[model samples]
Target: MARRERTRHLIELGGLVQKAGLVELADDDRATLYGAMLDCAARVQADDAGTVLALWKRRGKRAFDAEETAEEEQR
Candidate 1:
């Protein structure tokens, strides 16, 4: 059950990548997609990691909130 849950979690993360249009933007190139993620990881490892992470968190939260609002309006 734990393994299944983990698999689902990973799939949802992949869905976010697709939803973000990275898959299409990279033309389905796995290497490029991974490199982009690596760059994000590097940014989080920098001296201003906290500030960088906070900005990303805020942006992600806003995006999620906007998506939810749009879905609710459609309903």
Candidate 2:
């Protein structure tokens, strides 16, 4: 993906995270998310559809982890 597109995706994901009340993500978690986003974006830019999809899958896992952590904290 283009730089602009990558930035847009990151912003979109950030919004989703905020709405999910997962804004308390640790610095390491945030970095991981950002890094994954960047990796996927780069893959897309390189026209590697498979790699992009894989990166997105990884990103989803990270998001799930964040959500689970937040829920656990409420208990």
Candidate 3:
């Protein structure tokens, strides 16, 4: 059960990557996608990581909220 849950979690993360257009932007190249993700990780490891992470968190929340609003309007 735990393994299944972990699989689902990873799949959802992959879905976010696809949703963000990285898959298409990278021409479906796994290496490019992984490299981009590693770049993001490196940025978050910087001295001002907290500020960078907060900005990203806010942007993600706004995107999620916007998506939800659009879906609700469609319904």
Candidate 4:
């Protein structure tokens, strides 16, 4: 990916962590945060992933779209 795209990807992933309440759950511990993400990755690979992922994706998209709309309206 290009540098700009990579940066945006990282920012979005960070937002997901924040949105999931992981920041507080990890309590500023890098290892804890990483381990939690790893666990999540593993869980996503399990059965029922499709249904779970669809719901998550829908929520994330709605949140991102709402933020964009709010920002545009503010301008």
Candidate 5:
């Protein structure tokens, strides 16, 4: 990916974390955040993966839709 695109992708992912309150849950502990991500990865790799993915997809779309709505309201 282009550098700018990659940077934007990373920023968006960080925003998702902030939207989900993960940053506050981590309490500035990088290790805790990393560990939580590893655990999520393991869950995604395990059985019933669709369940995890579907839930995440719903949540992510909800966040994106909310942002879009907020922007439209601002306009």
Candidate 6:
């Protein structure tokens, strides 16, 4: 996974997210999607520990938020 490939993957994910309709997503949902995209990008950009760490941090927050929301809804 080279840098160029990683960038391309990110761009594609972004396109998918847009196509899915950003307006339909709650802020937390959008954040979750963003985190997923970043994680994918990091995987494609292998060996870049800094990038991986950053994405993980961001994604983790979003994922946690989403989970919390889901739990609240169930309660």
Which candidate gets the maximum lDDT versus the true structure?
1
Task: Report the lDDT tens digits of candidate 1 across residue range 1-75.
Answer: 999999999999999999899999999999999999999898789759989989989998999999999999999
After superposition on all C-alphas, the RMSD of every candidate to the true structure, in Å, is 0.9, 8.7, 0.8, 3.1, 2.2, 10.9
lDDT of predicted model 6: 0.73
**Residues 1-75, model 6: lDDT tens digits:** 699999999898776566446535735486777676687777867877787778868976887688789999999
lDDT of model 5 at residue 59?
A: 85
The models' CA-based lDDT, in order, is: 0.95, 0.76, 0.94, 0.87, 0.89, 0.73
Query: Model 2, 12-68: lDDT tens per residue?
Result: 977876665545554438776667668757878888788777886898789889989
Task: Point out the worst 10-residue segment of candidate 3 by lDDT.
Answer: 41-50
Give every collision pair in model 4: none
- Candidate 4 achieves a global lDDT of 0.87
- Return whichever of 1 and 3 wins on lDDT: 1
Off by over 4 Å in 2: 1-46
Instruction: Work out the TM-score per prediction.
Output: 0.93, 0.39, 0.95, 0.63, 0.75, 0.35
The model with the greater lDDT, 2 or 4, is 4
Model 4 segments more than 4 A misplaced: 1-21
* Weakest 10 consecutive residues of candidate 1 by summed lDDT: 42-51
Preferred candidate (TM-score higher): 5 or 6:
5
Query: By TM-score, who's the top model here?
Result: 3
Give the per-residue lDDT of model 5 (tens digit) for 1-75.
699999999999887778788889999688998899999999899859999899999988998899899999999
How should the candidates be ordered by TM-score, best one leading?
Answer: 3, 1, 5, 4, 2, 6
Error of 3 at 47 (Å): 3.7
What are the per-residue Cα lDDT tens digits for candidate 3 across 11-60? Answer: 99999999888999999999999999999999889749989999989999
